[model samples]
Target: MIDFFLAHQRNPHFTGRSSILKDLKGALTEGGPAVLIGPDGMGKSAIAEEHGRVNVTEYDFRLWVRAWDATVLATDYAGLAEPFGIPHQEDSDLQDLASSIRTWLEENERWLLVFDDAPSPEVLEEYLPRPGSGGGGVIITSKSPGWDGDFAKIEVGPLDPSEAASFLLSLTGQEDAEASKKLAEALESLPLALELAGAYIGWTGVPISKYLDIYRKRLGEISGRTSGLPEALVAVADISTEQVRAVSQEGIDLLRLSAFLAAEDLPLDLLVKTSALLADSVEMGLMALDRRGLVRRDEEPLSVHPLIQALAYSRLDDGERKTWADETVRAIGGAFSTYLGDLSTWPECARLLPHALASSEKVEDLRMGSEPASLLLNQVGLYLHRRGDLAGARNVLERLVVLDERFYGRGHPEVATDLNNLGSVLRVLGDLRAAKGCFERALAIEEAQDAPDRLKIAIRANNLGTVLRSLGDLTGALAAFERALAIDREAYGPNHLKTAIRLNNRGEVLQEMGDLDGAKESYQLAFRVFEQFLGPGHHYTQRARENLDSLSQSESD
Candidate 1:
């Protein structure tokens, strides 16, 4: 048995890849070539190196090449001359040496060649040995998912929890299962992250239990390794996005935007469509970033790792962070409107919802009062309210009120609008006093306006009356309802839908006050308006009809 050549030895600490090694062996035996494809730092290169280490005795000549790109692949091939003892002068043409090595590979049997971090299958095709000429095996590692039928594709994925925990315990030389499990889960059992965590602990001598606290405080430090550290983790990205930064700055811009949002299943369409940059440039930028494995551009959505987002975010200057945060808020706010919270817009709203909250949080954490954030929170509050998420609605509405006040002043109509919506959410949540307070503040703001908008005044009065009635303040409710009724009558005239809604609201208060005749008249008038304007089949019209029927039943009884 000949001693095979492998440039890097198998990692002494490599863990949990027996199944993958078996798959690699099977794939290499059956194929033109075997490619390990996945997101960057999922241990694709390590596995390939380990596969070579495991099969050392099976082959005569084994070559490990870091085929980063075409030029590097060629250089690696040329350098192979020295290892093979082929005569070559210092000024020998690299092409000639590569050609000679290609010839040698073609003529040999039981030989193995590995291209780690291959730039592309197209570039690699030029360097591989001719098919069916020799019993030689080849393996490749890449971030790209797409591969032609000529290669067998094996996916490198996250390590299982047990495997990850074991790796940590082994590396730290500790027997603490609980701490190891906690640490592994925090890192999501990602091999590269685990390796970095292990390396950090080994170097610092930090116990696994205390390591998590340090990790939280110094995330960038752990993700980007220390001096003289092996290159597994990165602070800015999985792969070098310097080219993306230089050429497709918009692509880097897209990544900056992604950093403030949810890390996984991020809607690709929203990011591309909402970007302020020209669509074509942004698209091209995304492709460039995708090619480098900086952004994991899957078929539907683009996902960023949490570590990627944290690093990208941490790298931004405060000014840059604010600009991008505001941009994110505007993107979500413009897409999500308070007017359309129906089934028609549900899917888009659902997709945009996480991003909206994420943006809101980012701005809030920075203590930056962005006016655009109010718009996003308002629509988010409304959507949550309509979706029967009352708690979520109240929480968002509360944030919106504070933001509106901060950005638009306490007496601004925007603040009134936020207060009104918050009151409605509070009312539904069974907090009558808090609901009444919100409604009262909203109405006071509206009434204090020098020339109040009549429609807005009516809405404020109407919401106040509803909440007042809920609090059992019949007299206060009646006055508020009358204020709304007078405003709507003068502003919209008698038969308008706005008057009808106010009339229906007044009717509810009158009935609660035991004024049967007044309540009946109001219901009849509301029913007439809804039937004439919205048609009898409309839910609002049917609701009024039901109001009348229930009132008649009460009178007959």
Candidate 2:
């Protein structure tokens, strides 16, 4: 006769984590306890629960408990008496009943017990089963870190980028790999948040590409009790917050400030740099946050999960949010070097660039102080332009223009500076007419000032000249260059590099306008200034010498 068989059903949405599962099973097979630990929302509980579900038939009895609090742990322990066949009455002493359950585990074999969402290893000691000759196994899920050396510990972290994207595609039936990858990254590869996003996509049929736009618009709503994400995620964040707050107020402050910055490898020293707080104080705060498993202290540059950042950001009041945003701006501006051509700034700029852009977005959205915003972002835009990311440069500069204009009026000198910087990017991006418009408006703004900033006007004019030259308006180009030269010659004198740049612009326009001797004279003066100021081996000097050689070649031909 054929035998009836049943299969252990698995969660269809669960994917990846094969390696972690292997480590867990290997640890469990030794007739020992295995611990799964990580930050909340990393899917530690899901992983542990999945392991239990699939191995139900392997043990004589299997049980799960939620042990997030002492009361819950006590009640769950007492409630497990019947499962292990221990006799108990409703009115019996709960402590005796729990001890009875523990005794049963000491006596019995082939039983597996799971402690899910354990508050800590200390709180968990009372309820844990002692392995007997019968050889039972144990599993635990927790956000607490540093399990004792006795238990086998498995760490669950964010999913790999590919696996996370695949999970979304599988769950939502989305066929686009790029969109899936984008969504996965935006969610920062956290499992519960990914599940929430995938569920939202499936429920609404919103294209994954459009989901982030909607998410940014509703970040506050989604992070709160009224959420696009499920309540569990918010609960996890709030619980974690309370845990950190209990141990360290400075940690809570740092976490809040972190919410307003980029959600990636934040330098460990940033809290001290931005807050002017003592390093030891910040170190203690970080250690406190780390022990609670709210932040990872092991990573070189500390990281906060993007979802954690979003939730923390949503918890802030408007005024408090603005204050954090200001702090972020100050930090970025203090370190972000604006000298676009300087190589020394590149490493630090690359490190801080992501945070700078994040801070810029926040400052613009809040309409907070634009001066600080510009201080950080102007360098960000310039650095991008220098690095050949014209589109990125344009995006950064455009944000600054809107922010500075709104905060300081259209005609403010700051507005002109933003316009001039943006114009440079637009010019490089092949939007000559748009660049011309930007430059003209900037020049007008600088020219209109009661006490004109001549150096500023010179910058505006020099940029205006190049766009005009690109547009074939050599006459207009020459006039603009001439104005720039006169200002620089007075302010910085004929020997300065600024005066040299104006002379080069002037020579180029003169050559184009068919005045060879005029061009030669201008080039010679610019070449001398470039050679003396920039050194003979500098690229600026080489280019200047090349220009002089070009004029001689024209005469030779």
Candidate 3:
């Protein structure tokens, strides 16, 4: 049976986990409770079973329990007795049977308990200790993080890059190194992701890169819209969420809320407090998440990949998202208001606000007079900017500026900051006239505020200068550039890379205006700044040299 599993494990199809296997061996030999933690299909069960049989003679008895069944209301000792074939005396009660096993283990020097997927921390901590005597140990493989006792936790991260590379090669049966690199990135180097990709590759007999494109399109179907993944891997995460949701409405609520939180290892208290669900519900939901491979919990923190989170969040449609977001926000706002004195709790409040805004009905209502509003606007700006939605980006920043001016007062640096941000969007959209107005307005505000926020002011000044140059207003551009350079030279000293960039910007402007000598002088100064600040080999310095060469060649002609 071990050989059979090993054979299945080795198929080029077999994703390697050398690191996890090594840690498993170390924990088994070290004589302590050991944990093998990872998501499903990463082969935690196989490893645990292999570890159990590694040294048959090392233990007097070894027992594996099917603890995941929800119908079993009994403890591990009683629940495991039938599987272990420990004869139950007709006269003895369940408690007596449990005691007898505990006594037997205490008397025996060798034993092992393989509690595969222990249901909950309460179950493990309250009733699931190893019954065996000295020299024996318990090995648990769980997706959940709660562990009590002196256990060595071995978290199984994704397969190593080399292992992943080899796996991809085998899957596609391809020899190209470039294709392998591209495939690895496509899979996020996740074992399950790679496995899914491999299956898709194997099924289609397509090129690895071609398969990657298909995989992305297929998986991206749910990327931001739904939580359902390909059917093959959905069970891994779905079972976890479903089980936790079944345990209680609160558990279900917690699971739903956690879907919106990041798919990284999260702290236990974070789920407990941030979730609108009850405390016990949160624990069960966590356990369910682990069991299903939707999440993998470790001693330190609970984490989920962006892919998993994407799927989970997709589970909520527009309506569900709105309801969840509303409830999450109200709960978070109340938590923040009531728990203001406890700064530790404040972060949870902060974390949930964005989630609330994801489906928030009234953006202004949620964002008004709040830090969350600023963060939301920034995130919106980022989204728009990435999508080349310059008009949309400008609108968000402009709104942010107006809101800041109304709430934080007219002279607040936030208003100036938004103006600069709006200017940036306008420039990107090629509306240089509007962009210039935005920049000049911001620069005037900065000069008046003079709030000692020189770094920010310097950036705006430099940007405004660039915009002016872009608009063919070289004189105005030159003035703005001079002011920016003076400030940067004072604040960051002459050799700073930012100063170099500004200098480079001015040189480009001079070159555009046909001032060959001035351009050459500015380029040389910029080159010196780059060389001194960022080293001779830096990319920007190389460009500066290229520009100088081009100008020198032109002069020769």
Candidate 4:
């Protein structure tokens, strides 16, 4: 590989694929099976063949077979055996072929078998090692993510921003940083797409943006023969799908559905929930697709290449696109409604929020049932914090705060409602100190706003008191809880259900302060409120009963 690159030195035009070579190095040194999965024209084959030749340099034997061979010639054993100096026997039966190749492979101490553009699983499965035959490490490159082996699965995504820029500038003969950045952005940060655009620009002498506009208008044209290169990009996408379809039509549909997803990654649960297929079936099908290189597996989600997304979008006519968009919105609304309170459901809601907002009649229209849109956004912040997406969550919550203020007024109960929610997210993000400040600020805002709704004020006071308790300011927590209790009692009378919630909150604060007797009294009051308003067997009423018994027993002891 070094000699080849050195021989072609002066052609600094090879861009965005340096990492592919690096991965090849890691895989070869590790000495096991590896599957190189990437989109078309991103140089998967070039890196595999070149690096395999370089690394297995001193091996007793090396074998390379195009994946297409299995589809065409039914098997590659005869061709691969030649390198090991094994001659094909005339009138050899299937048993003879398997025995012959197994013996040859087992004999070689450090052999490398490179399967280039391997056939679909349907064709390749017939030729996969019978038990105990695949003794040595093998490397396979295909358009899809293949199965897990004892080795690694190196998925080659598009180039990082810097690599994409360097590649584009080198190819277009343009050294300007600004021009390259524009081109890179326009090409959607895809390596092959950028390379093709660069070749077109250099050949035609057109400006980068001009070509980008053409890309937007007619992306299909860019993949065809022109600029002295083969239509490699389109050919790769189509051929990979054709191969996948040969094995599983359902897998192809999964890939197509992946293209419909707006986010870069889709979680496993979302896949099962949104798709028509059963969870286990979808999981296996997607895993197969991952092996084939049509889709990729991220840590907790799966991704399709940007170029594949573009191609998928292009394939949809206007009506079909609209239908997909509308159906997606409806799915999102349903998910948000069912799973709003639970934190585990946040990612599902977050993934659906954008599509819902874009296609739904209005944001307000989607905020129905248990999980209203405003509360859904608040939950999104919590999930974002758990995922270490503080900046993103903060951005969304800040905008949500503004929306809340505009719709419900700065001091209105609805606005104060989200203020406490936002503060909770901020606290978990390691700013509990700052979060305490936000709660206090909201309390002040709520107190100043002239609303006749004392229940709203009680809610604000209770929430602020809770924040104070979490911040370890027990004295402040007690005072705020007392104020909330007083307001609730004045507005709804002592035994009202709302007052019971305030009593439970105050009991929690009293418990924090080590006042067991006061906490017991507070819990007793809350239990009575529940018994009167909610009756027995209700979830919250049961919770109140448990708290009362626990607090009373603690006081007795």
**Per-prediction TM-score to the true structure, in the order listed:** 0.57, 0.57, 0.40, 0.41
State each model's CA lDDT, in order. 0.75, 0.74, 0.60, 0.59
List candidate 2 stretches off by more than 4 Å: 1-224, 276-280, 337-345, 490-500, 524-557
lDDT of 1 by residue, 245-265 (tens): 776777787788888886545
User: Residue 25 of model 1: what lDDT?
Assistant: 96
10 residues in a row with least lDDT, candidate 2:
1-10
Output the better candidate (2/3) by TM-score. 2
Instruction: For candidate 2, write residues 1-557 as lDDT tens digits.
Output: 11001111243678889899899999988766798988767877567667766676777766666565454455456667766667865434556777788877778766777786776778777677654334677788877786885688888889999999998888777788898898788777878767766755664577878876655445454455533444445543454466567767788887887776765557546546655432346766787665444554444657665566777787888988888888778777877776656676666676676677777888888877667887787777776666555666787888888888887899999889889888988997799999999999999998899999988888899999999999999999999999999999999888999899899889988988889899989989998988887899988788778878888898899
lDDT of 3 by residue, 154-222 (tens): 886667777778887886677766777777765657676665455445544678777556555555543
Pitting candidate 1 against candidate 3, the one with the higher lDDT is 1
CA deviation > 4 Å runs, candidate 3: 1-363, 383-399, 532-537
Clash pairs detected, candidate 2: none
Model 2 backbone overlap count: 0
